[model samples]
Target chain A: MRFEVKNASFSYKNDRKIFEDVNFSVDSGDIVAILGPNGAGKTTLLKCILGILKLESGEALLDGKDVRRMQERELFKRVSYVPQAKNTTAAYTVRDTVLIGLAAELSVFKSPGEAEEERVRKVLKELNIEHLIDKKCNKISGGELQMVLIARALISEPEVLILDEPESNLDFRNQLIVLDTLTKLSKRGIACIFNTHYPSHALQRANKAIILSEGHTVCGDCESTITAEAIEKAFNVKATINEYSDGGNTIKTVVPISVIR
Target chain B: MVEKKSIKILRTVLLIILPIATAIIALMIGRIAISPKDVFLILTGQGDMVETVSRMTVISFRLPRIILALFVGAGLSVAGCAFQGLFANPLATPDTLGVASGASFGAAVAILLGFNAIPVQISSFIFGILAVVLTVLCGRGKGKGMTMIILSGIMIGSLFSALISFVKYVADAESQLPAITYWLMGSLASTDYKSLIVGVPPILIGILILFILRWRMNLLPLTEDEIKSSGTNVLALRAATVLAATAITAASVSMCGQVGWIGLLVPHMVRMRLGSNFKTVVPASISIGAVFLIIVDTVARSLTASEIPISILTAIIGAPFFIYLMRRGGSFR
Candidate 1:
């Protein structure tokens, strides 16, 4: 499966241009990490790709079909989005929250039946969160909430998973856990695109990195795309890209030392 | 799991039995007291001679009030639940969009203009819907959020409330003023079979639509961007929910003046006790709200020879119960 954006442009009220011209694509089994500074329109770009935000010009396509023209059910069956884990005030249980992912599949005016419930159960079990099936979401920790959100997104079994800053609120261990989950999902042939503040995470987990900076974007394989020069260009920070060996695998990490004009 | 199963079964049973029990107790405790045995026989159409007066009293007076109260309570509760879910605010209610205040303003105008009962109800219903429409229009934008909707509702609600106060200021000193004030305070004393025939259908249809959309309603608490990503038409869904909720609220408020608390309180109580599942919350709110208002109405009628306004009793009961809930720190947040 392939999802591509071609010359997509967007502007807000008063003609404030967010994305001047952006282009990127992801094939099945590829993970794309979006890196940028705050307010760089990273989330806006994700929304444009998800078809939640209408483009001012150009289009996004999913598997050679215009995403804007696809029916909601058909489109949702192929692409799932996991939004940033804002603490939802609604006290839905873990099962209740996850079941909503399959809403497009369920017929309107009908509740999920036994078969659908069984599927939800199986997905939660597969995610190793079956024990939290009945727990109210407000009671869960941030890391657990992220896992629950991922489980919700996966319940649809989509070909493409789009996540926005999936590890934003997570601690070090939990960040690793989210990255590990994305890698495993990528290995299963679900194309994953996630934006992150941590470039080290992008270096460690993403096969493809797209750096969105100054209304322009650069997309390529992770190693060449996320260099110290690119990091300096995008964030205006003096940084170094270092290589280290961990358990017989080469790992690249970005270290920021100072701000540059 | 086993305990949950039993609790689910118990809740189902209570949902069925509570309203019936409250209705029976209500029938027995009215102004002309009849024994429960007599009440049962009279209701079943099997009582003879001495029960005839009692039977007429039950059917003509008490029964219509009970039926109207039950439906109005159910309608308001379901609308409240839908609103709470739609705005993702636990404090939202059927009247949050100014339907009650607008309906009161309409009723006050009707009274000042010397319109009769049916015309007054029609006026109230139209104005109630108008208030909500004004709120929606004021809040309309590319992607209006919870804060905008709530803020517009407050604006429209206050406007109508001020209009109501103006109507009262100009109303005749004795007859019209007392009548308008009493109606504004709320009571089921004037409900009859005719009002029930007119009022029940809209409320029932609204409730049915909301129940059918209960699972979809659960999505309302999610962020707007998240809802859009879920692949449903978020704007269309939100409009339908608002329409359904407004229909019930307008109908209920037109028939009975400003009966408060049931709409705001019942849904939270249901969520607190039974979990925040709209599939369960909608139906549970209906049953519990019906019972609560029926009991409150019974108390209103029996506590004094002159009937008490239902709005007062609802606050009297609802405030303390809600405080108790706060102390317990139930699902309210």
Candidate 2:
């Protein structure tokens, strides 16, 4: 499956164009990371793709079909989105929260059946959250909550998964867990598009990277295209790229390395 | 696990027992010293001791009033719970959308226009639906957030309230003014089988709808994208739910005048006990709300020689509990 955005442009009030002529595509089995600083319209771009926000000029298509024309349920069947972490709290059990993912596939009046329950259990186990299944969602740690959210998203068995800042609130171990999970998901032929501020995670997990700056796509490629110059230019910070003996690259901010006297 | 199950069982047992207890107490109070046996006989349609006057008072008058109280209480509370879930805010209630005020204005206008014999019951039902439609139209925004909807409701409510006040001023001083005042204060004094028959259907239908959609209502607090990804149409579902809730609320208010507190407070009481799952919250609210209002209305009628307004009793009880809940951080964000 290919998720394509062709010359997509969006504006808030039909006056201020947030992004103009943004283009990208993600193939099945591809892990694409969108990297940008704050206010770069990375979130907006994701919304445009999800059809939550309207496209001003171009279209976002899934498998050569216009996303806008696809019914919400049909579009959701193919693409699942994990939004930014919400502060809303509910006393719903983790199982209940995850079961809601079956809403699109289930009829309006029917509850999840035996097969769906088994699938939910499997997904919870895969996310290493089987122990937390009966616990209140509001009572979980942030990382666990994120995993629960991801597990919920996976319940739909969507081909394309878009996450906005999945790693934002995670600790180091959880971040690695999420990255590794995305890698495993990609290997299983699921296309994962995640927006992140962390470039190293992108370098480790993403087969392709698209960098947005000032509401425009500045660069697009695999790891080689995301150079220290591009990172420094996009973030407006001075950085030095170090190549390891194992043929890996790390970009570190040189200016922040030394303290002022 | 056994203990938890026992606790749930205990809660369910208590829900059943509490309403019966309240009804017994309600029957025992007031100048009538009807024994439990006679009360039972009257209820079961037997016993020579059940005199014509007492039978009429108990079977026809008090029984219907109590039943109406139960229905109105349950309806308002469930509607409140649904509204809270729909708006994804604790503060959201029937009044939040100005349904009460809108209905009141509609009813008031009908009264002032010499539509007295048209039956206050029918006037309220029509106005209640009208108010909800008007509120929805006024409060609607193009992809706006919950805050915008709430603000729009407040503005519309104020507008309707002002209109109601103006109507009150122009109402015929000799006949309509007093009726309008009594209606505004809210009473079960005029409640009868006729009004109950008209009001109960919509209220029951609305509550049933909320019961069916309770789980889906749980998803409203989540982000739009999250809800969509979960395979639900957030906008359509929310609109439908709000409409259903508002319809019930309007019908209840029009039927019973403006019985406050039950809609706003009963859900909070339920939440305090059972947590916020609509599965437990909706049913608990219905039960507790019905019982609470039934008891209060019983007290209102019994405590005075003449019937007192239900709102006065509700406010007296509900406001202090609301304050206590707020202070105790039950309402803290």
Q: Write the per-residue lDDT of candidate 2 for residues B81-183, one digit (tens) a residue.
A: 8777766666667776677787777778777777653354456556655666666676666855555666776787788889888998998888888988897
Best by lDDT: 1
Per-model root-mean-square deviation over C-alphas: 2.8, 4.0
lDDT of 1 by residue, A99-218 (tens): 989887887788876677787799888777899988988899888888888898999899999999999988998888899999999999999999899999999999899888874568
- Candidate 2: lDDT of B286? 79
Question: Any idea what lDDT model 1 has?
Answer: 0.83
TM-score of 2: 0.87
Misplaced by over 4 Å in model 1 are A87-89, B1-3, B47-50, B95-97, B110-122, B133-155, B170-175, B320-333
Candidate 2 structure quality by residue, lDDT tens digits, A1-261: 998988877778846766677777889999988888787788988888888877888999999999878888898888888776555345577887788777778777665655886788999998788999788877788888888888888998999999999998789998888888899999999999999988877776787888887644554675675777677767777665554454464433223122223
- TM-score of structure candidate 1: 0.93
Q: What is the DockQ of each candidate?
A: 0.61, 0.43
